[model samples]
Target chain A: MIKTSTQNELIQYVYNELADDACTQLEAAFMHDNELAEGCSELLQIQNLLDTALKSPHQRAVQNILNYSKSLSLQS
Target chain B: MNTTTQVSDSALVSLYIAGNENAFEQLVNRHKNKVYTTILLIVKDTYTAEDLMQDAFIKAIHTMKSGRYNEEGKFSSWICRIAHNLAIDFFRKEKRSPMITLEDGSNVFNTMAFAEDSAEQFQVKEDTHARLRELIQTLPQSQREVLMMRHYADMSFQEIADSTGVSINTALGRMRYALINLRKKMLNSNIAYDKNLYSE
Candidate 1:
């Protein structure tokens, strides 16, 4: 069974935020543990869900920024 | 004018400081989407987010003009921090809850209807965003902030810690809880992480 600390490490591993040595250790652990591997898959899916959920800002926001920047350049 | 791809953020910063207006445009264009998305996630309103984004760019320009712009960090991260702070400041000033809650207190997800429209693809995209936002709103403030910074602002855990005045481990722990909490919420809520549902 994967411990809470291992689950935490798995979170970092899925995000690719772990350092090299820790990442290697996690991968090795996953190889030996089916449960850990399944947990990793679930976390990865969550990450992908987050990525899909993000919305692009409206074009009006982009235009507003451009106009503001132009005004600033003119004043300088 | 050099192509935007050819210039690094630092180089663009230098050019803008050296009075090249176009360079500043390139820099803003390069990172505007990320900055806007980052702010929008926190503020959760389109008009207010747009205003805050403009304010953020103006603030960045003011800092650069006043010789206060630190060149040590990535320009994108610098602007993102400004956007994030502006959103936080708004919440504080208005004394508004950052929570995206509805009237019934059952969470926004339960009220949403994922109806298929003529533009089926766009409908799916909107539904996915709605579902995700619901899940995010369910998270505690700290976890939500860390998740947004990491995913939307593209900040490292160390960067998030620095911005939030926490230790790296604390930031990492927040992220871990955020993911775990989100996973639980998704499962319990029956929110499928189907790629086909999101992809057009």
Candidate 2:
């Protein structure tokens, strides 16, 4: 099992900010620390899900803004 | 030469200031979706969010035309700050909180533990999308706004703080609480789904 210090290190690894070596260390830590592994895995999943779900709404809202702004420009 | 790729925000602002309306259009094209989505998350309604987004961009253009925009600030960030302020104004006028408070009164950490993890198995299925939208609707206005700024619009905590007049730590704290609350809602709703669904 990954030691406690290593498990803490894995927890501190921000998915977008981690270097390759740090990410690999996180992978190794996850292999040994089941609880930390599960938590990290779940959090990453949640992020992905949220990202996907928000994409369409984001696009639609932007389009609405663009159309509105264009109309305003024409009127002014 | 990929000229568009090389043009900086300051360059675009300069062009717009020089009376090139298309430059402003290009800037809006580049950042509108981000701005709109950020507003949508705060307002939680389609029509009002769209109106606020337009107003934000119009206000930015006015600022530029009036020679009030600072060259030091990034154009997108400046526009975002405008949008943020407009959203706050909206909430203030309505005399309502910005986020949907959780009815269960559970702590964020505990709620996260119970959230569903089915996004892994289904890969953005329609039901999953619906569930996510429903869960977001459950968040308080402040939490929803912070989450949208952080995740959808991809603004940093400092940017959110600058835009919302909140401290950086407060923005981060709201996002932290948002995630926890979202997780809790998902867990409560998805307990009947398969257990190993998220396991690779």
Candidate 3:
């Protein structure tokens, strides 16, 4: 099993927040450990899936925001 | 070609403050989906989400125009933090519980342009995405909160820890479990985790 610290670092690594030396160490560990590599793979897959799950607001709503911003600027 | 497309959020914020309307437009278009998604996940309704999104942006505009916009952090993270807070405040005031209230994906998924996806491909994408959103709502409140803050709001784990009153390690732990639980639930729900489906 991966140590809790390693798992926490794994989270940071996936999110691109890990420190440089720690990230290098994690990559080195990934090569030697099948479970660690698999865990990384799974986390990445979820991250991508979450990106796809973002939903957009309606077009009119966007237009309203833009128009309001412009109107406010015009008045000032 | 529009060169502002390559401008960073901080640069865009500066341009907007200098009264370049296009800069403000670019900023809104750039972060709108993430901002909208951040709010929608909390309130569980598209109409309310859209309104709250406007309120959030208006608040940002006021701050920027008043010369109070903070330049220390990423503009994406700062704007989304605002969106997240407004959504949470609305949730508290309404005293309504979050439910999987998305009856149709069309309302939430708007006309933002995408690559020329085939009709069949679009349907598959929509179904998988809608299902994933439902699964997100099923996450425990703490896990969901951290996930949205870190994942959707673009806040760093350290920021999440600071805002949520937890240690950075605890924030990271919640995020890890959030991802793990999301994967498990996606598999259980038969949602697509396939990279190929989204790569097109």
Best by DockQ: 3
Candidate 1 Cα outliers beyond 4 Å, as residue runs: B1-7, B20-23, B103-118
In candidate 3, what are the lDDT values of residues A1-76, reduced to their tens digit?
9999999999999999999999999999999999999999989888887888888788798888888889888989
Residue range with the least summed lDDT across 10 consecutive positions in model 3 chain B: B105-114
lDDT of 3 by residue, B1-200 (tens): 56554888889899988888899999999999999999988897788999999999999999999999889999989999999999989999998866556556365654334478877777777777777888888898889999999889999999999999999999999998988888888878777667777653
State the displacement of the C-alpha of residue B65, model 2, in Å, after optimal TM-score superposition: 2.7
Instruction: Quickly count the clashes in candidate 3.
Output: 0
Top model by TM-score, which number?
Answer: 3
List the global CA lDDT of all models. Answer: 0.77, 0.64, 0.87
Model 2 per-residue lDDT tens digits across residues B68-104: 8888756766677677779879978988764564324
List clash counts for every candidate, in order. 0, 11, 0
**TM-scores for all predictions:** 0.82, 0.61, 0.93
- Quote model 2's TM-score: 0.61
Instruction: Note the DockQ of each predicted structure.
Output: 0.46, 0.20, 0.72
- Which sections of candidate 2 miss by over 4 Å? A1-38, A55-76, B1-11, B96-127, B140-142, B161-173, B191-200
Order the candidate numbers by DockQ, best to worst.
3, 1, 2
